[model samples]
Target: MALDKRFIGREYGPFTYTIGAEKLREFALAVGGARPGAGTPGEPPAHVSPLLYDARAAKAGPYFDLIAFPSFAVVFAVRPFSAAIADPELAVNMLMLVHGEQELEFLDVMRPGDVMTTTGRIENIFDKARMSFLVVSSESRNQTGKTVVKGTWTAVIRGG
Candidate 1:
């Protein structure tokens, strides 16, 4: 069965997330190829910037605080996309779904203690070559109401 194109433009929630220094460090280190152990985020690889994991360095750096990796926005920004995929009304077939693509734009760096609110909507729904495509566009704003991130998430369902 084909996905209902009528569901296009359906909006998802304004999910809120608080950024923590530890989580930011963990994410950056892990993505930078660090291995985590009992209590540490592991040794950050040479390519990983100290500003991402060293509090002192970060405190003295340009942002003057721990900064999350650019892609870290996905942590909070993906809520809307996830919600849409799980919406009962949409009836997306989980077994047949696959992430097609993702694009994120970081307007500003994310810092620890920043409260992020994300909202998204189904931007488009279409079918091609026996497949269905679901596109969700999300926007994330900081506590001060500045746009911090924008993301386009795409999901493909086979055998549309």
Candidate 2:
């Protein structure tokens, strides 16, 4: 089935989520360090860096708690669109859909304890070679109402 062009500008969700320090710390350590408990890059010590997992040291800096990794927006942004794609009126080809690409623009620092509100919209949709390409844009804002991240998700549905 071809995607309904009428739904191109459809919007979805203002889903809210709270960033957790422990989860942020865990994500940081997983990405930044050489290895857990190994300390291979032993010079600076992992604790000094917010991405290295030292709860106390992370707070010593300007940010009172662990700062989220730049790409952490994925955790807060994707869920809001579940309803949009699942809409019966849209009739998306779920089994034939494949993620195409993603683009994220970080507007501001996202820190732990910040309440994030994310909303998504169907920005564009097109068809070519029996495939449908859909672009969904999701924006996330902090409690203070500042946009922290903007994510553009692209999905290609085969045989559309």
Candidate 3:
């Protein structure tokens, strides 16, 4: 069955997530980057390994404190759209779906202990040849009500 085009412009979720220091460090480790959220052992001056080892580097950084890796926004923001695409009423064929593309804009650095609210909307729906495309845009805001990240996720759903 083809996806319902009328579903375009549909909105989903103002989901909330709180960033935790442990999760941030774990994500950094999983992605194999310098431990931006891991604190140096012992005291500051002599014990510090460098900027890479500073857990509070984001705070000490030119950007913000406990800065999150940009990709981390997807952790909180993508869920709403995931729910939307999986909605049975959308009548999407799960096996036919392929991740098309993803674009994310970092408006502000995410910090540990910050609470984020993510909202998702179906931005566009179109078809080309035998494939249908669904484009979803999700924006995440910090507790301060500032947008921190905006992400666009595109999916290609193949038709029989």
Question: Which residue pairs of candidate 2 clash?
Answer: none
Q: Write the per-residue lDDT of candidate 3 for residues 1-160, one digit (tens) a residue.
A: 5577899988989999999876765565445533343462223334332332246665576754556666878899897679777987787788899988999999877767899999998888888888989899998999999998899999899882
Q: Each prediction's TM-score against the native?
A: 0.97, 0.81, 0.81
Mark the regions of model 3 whose C-alpha exceeds 4 Å error after superposition.
33-53, 56-59
Q: Across residues 1-160, which tens digit of lDDT does each residue of candidate 2 receive?
A: 8888999889988899999876665566565653455533233334546433565766786766667878777887986456667789888878998888899999877777899999999999899999998888999999999999999998899998
Using lDDT as the yardstick, the better of models 2 and 3 is 2
Off by over 4 Å in 1: none
lDDT of each: 0.95, 0.78, 0.76
lDDT of residue 6 for candidate 3: 95
Which sequence of candidate numbers ranks them by lDDT, best first? 1, 2, 3
Best by TM-score: 1
Candidate 2 lDDT trough over 10 residues, lowest sum: 39-48
Task: Report the Cα lDDT for residue 159, model 3.
Answer: 88
| Window of ten residues with lowest summed lDDT in model 1 | 1-10
Estimate the lDDT of model 1. 0.95
Q: What's the residue-level lDDT of 3 in candidate 1?
A: 84
